[model samples]
Target chain A: MDGITVLIISNNIVLEKDIEMSADSKEKQLIKKAKMGDENSFESLILGCQGRAYNIALQYLKNEDDALDALQESFIKIFRSLKTFNGDSKFDTWVYRIVVNTCNDMLRKNNSRKNTDSIYWNDGEKEAVLEIPDSSNAPEDLYDKKEKRDHILSCLEKLNPEQKEIIILRDIHGFTYEEISEILNCSIGTVKSRINRSRLRLRETLLEQS
Target chain B: MKCDKTREMLSLYIDKMLDDNLKKEIEEHISTCNLCKKEYDDIMEIVTHLNEVEMVSVPKSFEHRLKNALQHERSKISDSKIIAISDKKKNKLRMLTSIAAIFAVGLISVGLYQDIIGGVTDQLDGTAQLAQDQVMQERVMNNETESDLYNSKLYKSNLDEAIDEKQKFEIKLDVADDVQSSDALKPRMSIYGYTDDNSEPGSTKALVPENYVDNPSVDGDSDGYSKDYSTMMTSEEFSRALTIQAIERNVAAVQFYKGLIEDNLRDFNYEILESDFVQAGECRFRIYIFNSKEGYVFNEEIIAIGKDGEIEFIYTNEFMGL
Candidate 1:
């Protein structure tokens, strides 16, 4: 497997470059090679997808350490199950599914251990920290936007596990309904219904908060 | 088109799931119907707000940590394999030494026994009888101990089995467990029971298990119950109950697959060998079509329970055209 070593210049620069080449054909090619037992190709694929995978794990698990553990476990699973990838869904969607499963497993384990203190951030904490895009609004509107974003996260927390997953994938990750359906191993009709219901619940949650 | 029908399709329209023709119909209806248009606008606003929500980035060290962990796992696996190989070699050597020592001991014992023959055999027989009695007593005691141990194990296992069975029964009845509240629980329909009851209504009471008596209303026909009891469940309630069962079955299928994979305990990955697509089973689902009275539009939640008792959900936009 052909591997590319990306030199970390700076955070902002790396983030920009990652966004630019995020959907490059080379990444898929690397993933294909990695799936065929090429460690180097697998390494490159990991390097490319690691950020997003970690972000997803973080979103689900909340704790930095748990997120890290999930990320590693997810990568190992990806390596083991790479041969099962049929390219029916986007590589990212497949990767995200693995991450989500890993996170869920971790959540179950943590629940069994009664470890509630590790990742219990409410929607307010997430909103206060994360930045939201507001193209039409001025600097004065930034505070209100943040509050709304926080409200949304709080609403997200109230959703059922399945609803949360679908909403996050569709609204946050920007996955298409078809891609989500394939990743979730459900019919397209089921996927749409879940998204629709989840959105309604989210709206209800926000309205209730107001 | 009726305002209610137009309102039901508003979500699909926002989702872009509606066909072009249906979309045009909804658009036309919205133009004339203020209530429908207002509902549509509200849903769109919510969708837009959700879309604008930002995602948090993963920590910078996340990738590095994953790569390091993978490397560590690989090393550990390789090390264990090497250790196992070396251990096998050591065991073979130890076995050879033990065999040589056993042969040496047997040869020396035989020589000693041959030298002390004659009257010693008679005395040995007398002593052996007494020793045999002692051994028999010991054996009986050992057997008793073993039986006691086995019985204790059986007792504990039986207790566990009882608990599990009771828990499963409660879950089936929508009863609350120790871990969670069950106040808002809904009853689930059973496909096999439904078929059996539908075939013979009077016999439904006999077919139902004793545990199901607590939640007898799960039976769609209510088993020829009074009209008051029948009115307790709305049409939507009937559909929802059915959909829940369907979701349970669906989830059970997946759980069965997971169980098979876990049972093998092999590291081998699954491949799509072959698939036979068929739908032979009866619709074993409780379909909950909410907001049905207002219009034909309904949100259906199907619960499918598989043979293994695992539950899965399948929500559908059955009334998208309404």
Candidate 2:
């Protein structure tokens, strides 16, 4: 029984490894075809990742139009830069890196375009930073799940872009420290420290809002 | 460790990133220290709330919109390439025309003015007409070649043919041990039980498993398929009938989906898992597996065979607000 159990475990391990290897190769094949200008293959390549990619953009940009624009622009950049992709990292990671960069660029451009003289919150501000809600009247217990979630999202939006991104990738999406490092093009140590700082900031914001 | 030091390391501790000794030290400190423990709890609570936030679904028109953008990009690339190729020809033509003009000037300078001027003018006119015809002919040829390229290497059909030649279906019903419920947190709309009345408008009505329940409300009759679909057929029988009906209507789409799966998961064999006829279209289900004997659900790709017989990715169990 012990021998049979061992054999079964080993077989499962082998099976999993085989699946992983095949999946990686399949992506590589798609990348190669896309590089050679097979438009359909390129479409197939982005199809699986596009949903998550768009979500990431939405989280960063915080609007449907901006998110969709960023996604479209990112895919176009990916399509153009297919040849430059060295296969040093996961294709999904590379796509994500482009997306993050594009979103950051757009945000910067928009900020510059909508420059204001005052140092305080400008056009994009949802509400006053310290304008605490009437929590005494409607206590925390009264707020439903959706209201709580909305409150959290609103607080999340208050953080700096980098902090918001770190929280989004680490806490929300559940990407590993290593994966976050690759996507953000930062060190794993930086990812760790950044995650801690971001979480602390979020906690502070949540506390303030309540 | 001091409270400040412990506080700094608490996030990493929650994430389980520190080495064994450091982790043990942090744990020991947090146990004794109230301030550090409170800090740890706050961060952990924030992390928990963040994790509970659901993933956003792409807009309904995103895929369609992106495809158009990709096509536009492809045309741009083709147009640029065409321009590059014509640049060399254009340069050569410019040089030849310049030479002709220079020769005409030389003739005029030699005082053969009226005698050769008319002939020269006629020759230049003829050359201009020829160049115009050549440009038109090249454009037509280029278009024909482009169409031929598209027709011959129509990627989906090519993939289908290739897979059909090299592969055979290695499908099985064996569920893997690691097949956890993907939608455990959300209320599920299974054939057995649907606890939530807040089902989104135009979302999937029901996801029939092996033991399909015949609930008229869950049957998706309102979406305008045959009313008796769920009552009459088992999931497999229904899928088979739908596949046949879909093939009869749109053979290319069936082939396209087959190729897509094969392309998506190359050597990873998949089986047609549980399928349902839902929402005016046949919902085809597929799962990747390890082997016939000891297979598990690696990925469950639910494809909706559309009203036009095109394969659309349903992705989630429900469409989730399109």
Candidate 3:
């Protein structure tokens, strides 16, 4: 989950140029049917968002099982309460809000259990014996690159959950301020303020680590 | 803008949420103000790192699990609709109808409006739909409550006969006599119903579900068996069948639902209650009671057995008063 997020988020640089609203006419039609208790329609409506939902949960939980658990929980809830979506807001935002809530629920539950804090490097076992020979740089340079990547991730998990979500949503996911506000259920002003504050916190953490 | 004002506006300007004029003004201020400029550089670096954060691919199994869960919820909803047809109790039917109506009201405008709105769907158009409905109806009918339905008798079982006339289905009437669940808006008046405590979780004994019996293997096992629950029927092990699946399915469905609608109820333990078989027309079902096993609130979960004997959560309503 750690390295995977970097791969996907780095490639999603199209956010600046992509301005299409959440659901297309076809999706909107499906959404309508889904709201009418059509399971097939509901499945179609959620098909696209599932990947993003998984990504968000992965970023939040940093554990694969927890991420999937959050997603399963969120989708079930979404299906149950599809009736609550009144088209007042974008469907994507509604889905994002529920994903956030589900992640929060998982976090709260896991925190309550308080059994152990296990740091899992996803697929670490398979990658541990890797031999990467880059054409552009020496192995030492690549090692430094890997180190820096890990360092950034290490700093990320240090922030509190609110700061973590704000950074991920705004900077990594490149969601618009308005969209983030809707997702977080905050005002545009709050989104801006919080993003800045989160950025400030991350900066401090990186500086301290350095 | 003053330095303090400029500091706050910097974020908005960078995010493009601010006007051009203000952005220019802030840009000018940062040009003259080295301290502010350094602060902005630090913030920009943080944003760069944030953007580098990777996107993880969902594991192959995630889709598998999600589809399974959706199928599970679909079955539950379909089960609920069947309950509407099978349960002649006016109060219970009213509750189910309102639940359906509430969902419709919450949705933005939708089509197929007539089928699921106002009343139970009596004549669903498709064969698949009718087949499924008929299957559910048959299950409910097998519960052996046919005579009671004809006599206009309540859902009073021998559990009721053994206790007393006043104590039929005593759990709701007795244990539910408390403040309504915090989620319910209206304060509910308690009507004492059935209450029999079966708090010991059988998760210890039925380590594997009763229906999940071993299938004879092709000489793979010394016991010549491998665990398979593909075909589970209620009539085989009626009591064991309903309680286990009901507990598992209800918990999973509720957790899924609680996540979707943003409920803040903390995770609580589930206590299995006694189950009874009841029938109406073509549908036969086992009604199971699963209250909050311990601590926090007076919520009661009632689930039912489907035609194939799979379990589905009906509703979790609170009884108030006292």
Candidate 4:
């Protein structure tokens, strides 16, 4: 029985690796075609990464419209400058970097014209930006899960942008430290320390919110 | 390791990023230290919850909007490329013009500029005017009377106003040398047929009707030079001149011939996206007709008009990506 279990585990690892290799090769093919001005290839290339990109934008901006704007702008910048992408880093890392930079630029631009009327800021100085979900109509287990999720997300908003960016990149998006380093254009050591500090800051925010 | 050091490396410990010895040491410290263990547990729980946080999927309209945005960017890049090519050509022309001006000034200093260049220009003008007068005299001799000249079967006009205009135009050129004199100042219609000297009579070629006076400074006017005699032409004559230039030479006039081309293509439902002269003798135009409700270009055609009034398809492509 033990021998059989070991064999199955080893086979599964090989299968996963094969799948990853195929996916990477396919992405490389798409990037090559997209660089040569194939619109369909470009569309296909961004389709896979756009979801996580949108989510990152949404988390940073805390507004759907602003997130969408950032996504559209980032995609355009990516398409226009696609030839400059040398493929040193992963495609998705480059995409996310552009998205993050676009969002940062928008945040800086809108800082002076900040919309104080956001629903996130509606509950006065003490209240968290996002309200806890109305769990009364939901199943007890489901509602509990949702409340915890919302609470954590709201607490995420309370962190500084740097802390929030690192947490979202590491914990939420599941980018490895090396990938995060590439995306953030920092050393592996910096990414590690930043993630550690960001996670600690996030923990403090979550505790304070509860 | 103490509790503080263990806490500092707790996130990395949970991530399994610490080296083997450090991982072992942190694990041992956390096991012995209750405070460090609690901190480690809290951080672990937060990371777990963060990983479990529901991600926002893009709206349904996002891909479509992004594709449109990307298409727009792609078009802008292509337009900039076209502009860059045009600018490069303009820069070369400017450099050549400067060189020619310097050469002309040197000729002026040597007192040979007027004798050589001016004498050639005057001779060319005289020869062109002589050719026009001879053609006019031959037409008068063939008709036998001015009224018969107007009534000749050789002249075909779909519109009555066009016939009246042509008759008035011929009379004006025949009676007045001043009108003929002004021909040098006005735009000269240099017409060429699509068929080359070697090409068979029925074979399709590019019809070019170009204006040399528009850029008379350029010396390399390879457009076949059939001079138009009417100095001050009407818009109707202008249109006919352009169309005849296409039929005569296979090249087109200047950019304003767009309206005339559109009018001629009114029978077809295709919209002219862009029209351009491909070469000295070839006219190439991108035309499209939308088929889908979404308004994507379904059928695209690039066509050139031959001298014999035949339409030659240069390219017929379906499913042009917007």
Candidate 5:
């Protein structure tokens, strides 16, 4: 049993290393082929990141139909714009930014603009700028995790588009702040501040709802 | 640090984004600060809840529809690029023809065009035409008797076919690549055919010639020339005029011209035949017919280096008795 466990673990590490290197080299080859007007390589390249991109769009556009529509629109854009992809950064980061930008554009055009009210407090004034209705449940009373999980998605909807994207990228996608910064085309400092504000706002929303 | 300031950085502390010293400072401040601690706990709960939120599942119908749309989109893109390349090629040919027309106009202005029209028919009187295969064969491996075997009607059809199949200009059959210094490339004769950059679909690109420049970069004005190829002037004057316009002015050698030629002109060996002024139509040409076969066999080509250094016309023919 011990020998088998060690073999499996060692195999996993090697496999993981292969996956990382393979994914990178594969992407480079795919980008080159796709740029030269190879639709097969282009299809494979887009499909590689298709799942995450669709999920990101889903997080932004809530409706299942809209999410798929947004994803299709982004792919069309990426198809047309493949030649302009100079390969300055990871293909995934570039794709993420495109998907995110497309989602934002859709949001703007739909004008289903969520009120991005950021709360602030002063020592003299006894209020959060954006008020949260009081809740009886304490912050620690989140043990019924599944129910709270549903509330979080609803709360995510309430946060502004920027805040929601940062939260989704960080908490759900579990991307590092640096990765988030690169994908968002912003500094790590901006990513940090945005996530902090977003988390606080989301926490306030969750507390009031519960 | 103040409670508010520490609270601002509380999330970074959780994310391990804060430097250790700053993190320690925040931890210590929050240790004494209950309100900041409570705020920190609340934010932590939010993050925890979010992490548990299941990844939005992609609907099956959506996935199917997207793939279908993508297939259509992919084909559309490929078709457009293929179209773009072909369109660019057609444009390139038109551009070359325009340059040739301008060169012809220049010849006309100098009274050379009238002389060319008068003398061309008389120059090749008995040899009215030859079949394309017979012509190609005569220039290469075939004997002269093949021309007498074919009728005039067959020759005319063959001529139509040759024109329809993008008429060949200069055909260089180089046996080996011999690299020479870029500076060695002066007034050497060769042809350039503008082509699609994707030589072999997804092959590597040749190192961009730092020294290999084109018309705009070399001499600034490509169309600026003293005179056309065939002139009333002496042969030496004609060569001198070409040498001055193409060589002295530092004209750029053409890059890949699609199906015509590949690789730099500097890589090939060239022999300068005793060139003389000749005319086919209204166009005047410096007929370069060399009997010496350095590598294999060479043919009768009307060579004219444009003022832009572009080998505008490099068509070959097997004149019966050149």
Candidate 6:
């Protein structure tokens, strides 16, 4: 059993690395073609990046509609202003900047419409206190996983937009601290600090729920 | 290391961001301290769980919408190109029209000057007396007389054949009567004078038509009449009197022509010069004039006619000051 598990783990690691190498090469080629005004290349690039970008927006906005709006705006800006990009950073980092800017703009507009009131997450406490439902031994395990996923999202919502963004990029999106630094235009230390603080808060909330 | 230092390095150590030296020290501390080790394990578990959460799936239509947006942008760029082309065509047409107007003015002025000179020569020869009577009789026979010669189609048409022969005869008779009357009554002070300031006591009243009452200078004295007049007279009366005076005084015709130019040119600064070319079919002298001011500079031509036909000049003024 241990030997089977080890083989599966190694295979999974190799597959993940292959996927990463293929995606990186594909993205670079698409970016080059897009810079030459190839719309198809740009569209493909957007398709590749949309999942991660949408996830980041979803984390910040919580509302599916707002997240979609932010995602659309970010894509439009990325395509329209692609020519101005000097490619000093990775394409993903540049795209992240556009996404972050779009989200910030939406947040500002939302704040103005809400009469500048502070945003607070009332559901976080409730989510932390909510009991996890149990089923039979096997069902209970699956249910627990699902409950934990929901609880994490709820905790993410409780975080301020900045903290939520860092956590999503660093933890959920699997971006390195250096890449996050380029995207956010901050120091690696700052990225590390924010991720650490966000992770600590999320853990505390999870513990409270348990 | 202190607990705070250990705790700080724990997050970095878990993320594998710490250098080897720091990672080694933090790992050594975690091994020795149970409390710190437990905290480190909990943090690691939470980080690992967070990393394991699935990324949200994007909607399928996102690609379609993005493609449509790019296509829409291209269409807008093409539309602006069309607008730019149309604007260029409009500018070309405007330039052509301005050139045509300048040429037409030059031709008309020359025609008037020729007519004026021919009339004066015939009068000097005394052979025109018989022709003048015949012209008067012809004018009475034709029913084509207009109340206001300014609006007469005979005057507007460049073709001499278009003139109503009967109206021409009447004009000849009127001119003959005016010349004789002016010769007989030369004692009265010359009533017409030009002045720079309309407010000057002796300045002639403005010649604006009744339809132009809304004009700023129309109500010069606010006496209900549309324009200021030298003699307190209605526009029609003033126009008739001026016409009669222009016929009586051989020089009055030239003055009337200049008055027309001066009145119209108030809105533009211009210079008038006599052209050496003889007008084709008129007794009036042709003069070239142009608005010389920036933004108003345009080619213009004018014709000045003297009743005895001795005075005539034709000139053309280009858009530039000349």
Each model's number of backbone clashes?
30, 1, 29, 12, 4, 26
Error of 6 at A5 (Å): 29
Error of 6 at B136 (Å): 61
Error of 4 at B297 (Å): 40
Ranking by DockQ: 5, 4, 6, 3, 2, 1
Off by over 4 Å in 1: A1-29, A111-143, B2-8, B80-265, B269-322
DockQ of each: 0.11, 0.17, 0.18, 0.27, 0.27, 0.19
**Residues A63-174, model 1: lDDT tens digits:** 7888888887888877656654545456777787778877887887886675533322224324332233322232333347566665566556655557777877787776
Clashing pairs in 5: B193-B257, B194-B257, B194-B258, B195-B258
lDDT for each residue of candidate 2 in B79-170, tens digit (9 for 90 to 100): 97687547535644554565466556545544533434354345445544554455456557666563333233232233322222111110
Q: Per-residue lDDT for B1-322 in model 4, tens only?
A: 9877887788889999889999999989988888788788888877888899788789999877876777787789789778755754564465456546655654554454235335434545565455445546757777556444333333212122222222233333344344453363233221211233366543433332232223321222321221232333434554464465344332223232344345334334576676666564445566665332211223545554422222344454321211
> Candidate 4: RMSD over Cα atoms?
21.3
DockQ, computed on Cα atoms, for candidate 6: 0.19
User: lDDT: which is higher, 2 or 6?
Assistant: 2
After superposition, which runs of candidate 2 have C-alpha atoms over 4 Å from their true positions? A1-6, A112-139, A142-146, B88-322
Q: Considering only chain A, what is the TM-score of each predicted structure?
A: 0.70, 0.83, 0.74, 0.77, 0.77, 0.70
- Candidate 4 chain B has its poorest 10 consecutive residues by lDDT at B156-165
Question: Residue B283 error for model 1, in Å?
Answer: 44
lDDT of 6 by residue, A23-113 (tens): 8878777777886768789888777678888888877776778888898888877765665454457777778778877887788778757
User: Distance (Å) between predicted and true CA of A167, model 2?
Assistant: 0.8
Off by over 4 Å in 4: A1-22, A115-143, B101-322
Model 6 has an lDDT value of 0.58
Query: Is 1 or 4 the stronger prediction by lDDT?
Result: 4
lDDT of 3 by residue, B1-322 (tens): 6788887776677777778788888999999998789878877755666677677777887777777888887899788667643542443354446546545543422232232332212221232254435444654876645432322212223222222211111222223332232113122212213222243321112111111112212222212111221122212343354456445444433333323212112233334444333342112222333222221233444443332222344554321100
Q: What TM-score does candidate 1 get on C-alpha atoms?
A: 0.46
